[model samples]
Target: MTLTAADVPLKRPTVLVADDEVALTDSIAVWLSDSYRVRTAYDGHEALREFGPSVDIVLLDRHMPGLSGEHVMARLNEMSANPQAALLTATSTDDFRSEVDELGFDAYLTKPISKTELLGVVSDLAAAASESAQH
Candidate 1:
């Protein structure tokens, strides 16, 4: 018996979620774990430590002790990683849209994000990333 290409399982996309709030971080990880390979970091520094080329998406809290999400995004940029990144913060979109655009985030979502919204955005980002990788 020979295995065909379709017989092999596709690799799940990896999502790195970083937030200073332990419960929030854990919750998001749990929500995404069913569809993706999810990694959680409790701080910006830990986020950076966990990041690598294999990460397909990033969900970062805009404000954290030690290092902010902005700082982590900058570091990821410095590393030349192309993962789609989202700023998931309590900050209002009106106050942060320009900054989010300038910082090169692929998407932005305020805190209290519903599981449906989170999953939708991640699914879109994952699809985009996969499309880009193929070209």
Candidate 2:
């Protein structure tokens, strides 16, 4: 049977999650799956490969094996027009406060992040994106 546009599922906002920690990436993907179309990548290169213009938010690990999260963020910024970036790091915020601001991330999240915080950030990013579009 041919499906019409109304028969197709809605296209949710896409979120690219990049982290070296396999378990962490999986967990975050699960949490975000309900609200967003999550794309998971184990390393920076993989993340960069999967990133696209439709991605609404980027949850990136600060210290990956090859390209660091910071590096990936830089590349994403260059490729996409002002994508929302959230840095995931084990280090204290003080360690990267200056760097985060310089990199233009929308949020800074430390490791062991709670699902609530994760969802909140994604919600905020989505809201911001919606607002931007309306302007």
Candidate 3:
């Protein structure tokens, strides 16, 4: 039986990791590379340059030099096919709940984020995207 593209499983989610923390961003790309098409940007401007319709989700920091994460998120929301986004910030949940709620992010993850937690959310979104694509 020849296995074609159709026989393969779901498409890997293309995730944009946008954070000013170089180490954290690189580590996440390394961790998720095998399971996802991961992209990284050191700051908001770079993230905006790299982001496009192909990206399925964005893991964005709440603060960064030049354009801030919230600004980037707002711009992204303006795109016709906006990608799902999550706030990956060090800000306390209580501190940012109202702000995040206003932005309508797919998730809000505080910093020192565990690999398990990251993977869990990504996997869930990936599965949901795949399911939706099938219909």
**What TM-score goes with each of the models?**
0.91, 0.88, 0.87
Instruction: Report RMSD (Å) for each prediction in the order shown.
Output: 2.3, 3.3, 2.3
Question: For candidate 3, what is the lDDT?
Answer: 0.84
Which lDDT tens digits does candidate 3 get at residues 37-86?
Answer: 99999999999999986788888898899978888988877765556778
- Candidate 3 segments whose C-alpha is farther than 4 A from its true place: 1-7, 131-135
lDDT of 2 by residue, 63-128 (tens): 998999889988876865577788998988896689777888888888899999999988898888
Q: Pick the candidate with the highest lDDT.
A: 1
Residue 28 Cα positional deviation in candidate 1, in Å, after optimal superposition: 0.7
- The positional error of residue 112 in candidate 2, measured at the CA in angstroms, is 0.4
Per-candidate clashes, comma-separated? 0, 0, 0
Point out the higher-scoring one by lDDT: 1 or 3.
Answer: 1
State, as a TM-score between 0 and 1, how close model 3 is to the true structure. Answer: 0.87
Task: Compose the digit string of candidate 1's lDDT tens values, residues 25-101.
Answer: 99999999988999899999999999987899999999998999988888888888889889987868797688767
Off by over 4 Å in 1: 1-8
